[model samples]
Target: MEKHILYTTEAVNQDGLNGQSFIKTGGLTVTVSNPLNNKPGTNPEQLLGLSLSTCMNATLQAIEREHGLAHTAEVRVTVTLIKEENFAFLVVARVRIPGVPLKTATKLVALAKKRCPVSKLLSGSSYYQVQVVEDY
Candidate 1:
């Protein structure tokens, strides 16, 4: 078995009607709460979507830099959580790689999907989901 690296995050929440938690990690803080609570904060679902898209984008950016390529990609990830019997979530990763060939862009996104750690954890292959899109 391979050794596992641990990551830590802390959230502080107070007991109240308008209670929300702030997760602190890596010198940054993310405030989260349920939408039903009506408090002003980012929800967990939104954060999850953001994390996945950001990870994929970062991975692709790394690949671009490695190849000394010009231009960059802008990524937007929308995650939908379906309330079903089991864990059901769908992620739509829309990416726009301007000035790059369609074939190259598609290939980079494919590699990102395969290598992104968050995408690995939340596999989209087992369900009816479109993981990546190449937006012109």
Candidate 2:
């Protein structure tokens, strides 16, 4: 199979978790800070959760539209940073599709998990999971 490039963007983080991170395109910038601290900034865990939740929900919306259903999917991503022998993150994406049956929602989530770029990037890790839930 041939690979075709669609769109690309670059993000630069200069001071790790203590300063700022911005897009090379100059569109967005975010203050970075350690989650353990009380500083008002965004941490990696929160950023990861946002990315997964947004990507998964967007994918679910597209699938729902294709099936002639209204956009009613909600995705909640919980990211936990664990420290043992090494630092690892446990990511769980909880998805709820209101007005849709459990079976159908489950199928839609499964498909979204496969289609979402963030989900695919994390799918190989045992710490990542996507589940269909009755409530958001």
Which residue segments of model 1 deviate by more than 4 Å?
1-18, 24-29, 36-38, 124-136
In terms of lDDT, which candidate is strongest?
2
Query: What lDDT tens digits, residue by residue, belong to model 2 across residues 40-131?
Result: 99988998899999999999999999889999999989999999899989999999899999999999989999999999999899999888
TM per candidate comes to: 0.72, 0.96
Q: Model 1: per-residue lDDT, tens digit, 106-129?
A: 877788777888878766466423
lDDT of each: 0.70, 0.93
For model 2, the superposed segments whose C-alpha errors exceed 4 Å read: none
In model 2, the worst 10-residue window by lDDT is: 127-136
